[model samples]
Target: MKLAIQTSSGDYALGLIDGTGQLVNAISRAPDTAAAKNIGTLYSALMQKAGKETSALTGVMVDLGPGGLSSTRAGVSFANALSYGANLTLTGVSALEATMLDAKRKTDRPILAMRPSPGGACFWAYYEAGHSVASGCEAPDQLFSRLATEGKAFALAGPLRRIGTEALRATAAEQIDIPAADLACFAKTTPILPITNGTLTYLEPITNMDGAHHIAAKDLAS
Candidate 1:
C-alpha cells in the first residue's frame, strides 16, 4: 500500500492505495481546523482507521503545490521525514497536473489547467490528447488574448478563486470541480525532495517555480 498525502489544497487529504486489489481509501480534512500543526497526527490517525501500520507504506506520495504554502510544507516535511526514517520511496505530484488529470475524466476535449502563481499572473498549462502542449505563468488578459488568436476552445479546470475563473466565462468554458479525494487517487508519484535537508527551508525555496529554476530531485535523491 502507498501513503498519499495532499496538503496543497485549502482542504488537505490522505489516500491509501493498494495496487494489488486496486482498492483506495481517501480522507479529506481542512488543515485550518483539522490537523495543521502536526501532520504526523493526521498520518497516524489515517493508519489506525485503515487498519494499517507505518510499515505497510511502501512509498510516500506528496503534492508539490502551486497551492497553499504552509500546507504544502507540512505534507512535504512530514512525508520527507517518514521517507527518510522508514526507508520508504518518496514521490511528488504536481497539484496542477493532478487537477488536469481530474479534468480529463469529465471531458474528451483539450483541457486547460490553471493555478495561482506568485505574480498577478496565473500558472497555466494546456493538455491535448493527454499530453501537455504548453505551460507557464501569464496574466489573465494576455492568456485570453493568446487563446483568442489561436481560436481554440478549452475546458477549464483548477481552483476557481485562485485562477480567477471569471476570465474564462467569455468563452463559455465548462468549469471542473475536482474533489481532494479525486486528486489524491489521481497520483499513483514526486519531484523527489532530498531526504538530506533536515529542515523545512527547501519548502519555501521550492514553490512551483516552473522551469526557470532547477529542481534537484534527481541529483539529491539517494
Candidate 2:
C-alpha cells in the first residue's frame, strides 16, 4: 500500500493507493496555519479508515513544496520522520511538475504553470512536447500580455490558478487542484526519488532569519 500527503496548498489531503496506483480512499481539509499540531491525528484517522496501520505502508509520498512555508515544512518533516522511523520508501512530488502532468491529460499543447511569489510578480514554468522549455517570473504588468504573445493556446494548472486566471483576463482551459486524490495514483506510475533523503524542493528559498529578534520570536512560538 502507498500513502500520500499534500500540504503544499491551503487544502491539505491524505491519499492512499494500491500497487497499481489505484485510489483506495482519500480525505481533505483546509487549515489556514499551524499544520504541525494535527497532522498526526489526521494520518491516524485516515489509516484507521483504511483499516490499516502506519507500518503497513510500503511507500510514502509528499508534495515538496513551493507553497506556504510552515505547511510545507510540517508535511515534509512528518514524511521524513515516518520514513526514518518505519524504513519505508519515500518520494517527493513537485507541484509544478504535477501541473504539467495534469495539463498533458488533455491536448498536447504547451503548458504554462504560474505560482504566486512572495512579492507581486509570479513564478512561471513552461513545458512543451512533454518537456520543460523555460521557467522564470512574469514581467510587471505583463503576466497576461506575455501569454498573449506566445502565439499558441496553452493549458494552465497550479495553485495560483485563481489569481493567475484573473490576471490573464481569460478563462483557463484546465486548472488542476492539488488535492485531487488521483495525484497520489499518478505518483505511483511516475519516476520518483529512489530513496527518501528527507530533503524538500522550494521554488523560493526556504530561510529562517537569524537575529536576536528573530530568535526570540521563533523561540516563543516553539
Candidate 3:
C-alpha cells in the first residue's frame, strides 16, 4: 500500500492508501516542534490504525509546499528520512495541484489556488481547461488586477482563499474558497510520479522575514 504524509499545514498528517486511492487509515496531529516532534506520534497512530508495519509500505507521498517554511522543511525532512529507513520510493506533490484537484470537484470553472506567501502576497497557480496556465507568487491586488483585466472567471482554493477572494471581490472578479478537507480528498485521488530514491529537492524558502520568523516561532513551540 502507498503511504502518504502531508505537512503543508499546522498539522502533520499520515495515511495509507491502496492502489485504488482508498485511504485505509489517516491520522493528523500538530507537531510540538519544527524538528518533527510529533511526527513519530502521528506515524505510530497511523500504523496502529492501519494494522500494518512500516516495512510493508510500497510507496511514499509527501507534500512539497509553498507554506510555512520551517514546518514545510521539517515535514519534508521527516518524510525523506522515513522513506530511506523503509526503503520505499518517494513522491513529491505540489500543494497547489492538490488544492486545484479538490476545487475541481465543486466546479469546472478555471481554478486559482492561492497559498499565503511570506511577502504579503500569495503563491498562486491558475488551472484552466484542466491544465496549468500560470503559477507564481504575487500580491493579491496584483493578481486580482490582472484577472479583472483579463475577465477571468476563476474560483480560488488553498490557504490564502480569504485574502484572494477579498481582493478579487474588490476588483469584481468571481472567486471562492476550497476547504482544506476537500484539498486532502483531491490529494488522495491524484497520481504522482515517485521521486528517485535518495534524491532530495529543497523548496524555495519564504521570502518574508517577519512571516518566516513568525512561522519559526510556531515551529519551535510545536
- CA lDDT, every prediction? 0.66, 0.61, 0.65
lDDT by residue (30-148, candidate 3, tens digit) is 66654347677777778988788887788777776667677777667777788777777767666767777877777888887778776577777677866666666768777677677
Model 1 lDDT per residue over 68-111, tens place: 67778878888777887888877777676677877877898788
Higher-lDDT candidate of 1 and 2: 1
For each candidate in turn, the TM-score is: 0.82, 0.74, 0.78
Candidate 3 deviant stretches above 4 angstroms: 31-36, 161-166, 169-174, 179-222
In the predicted model 3, the residue pairs found to clash are 32-222, 33-222
C-alpha lDDT of candidate 2 relative to the true structure: 0.61
**Candidate 3 local distance difference test against the native:** 0.65
Candidate 1 stretches with Cα past 4 Å from truth are 20-23, 179-181, 188-206, 212-222
lDDT of 2 at 23: 72
Candidates by TM-score, descending order: 1, 3, 2
Among these predictions, the greatest TM-score belongs to: 1
Best by lDDT: 1
In model 2, pairs of residues that clash are none
Model 2 bad stretches (over 4 Å): 33-37, 138-143, 164-166, 170-182, 185-222
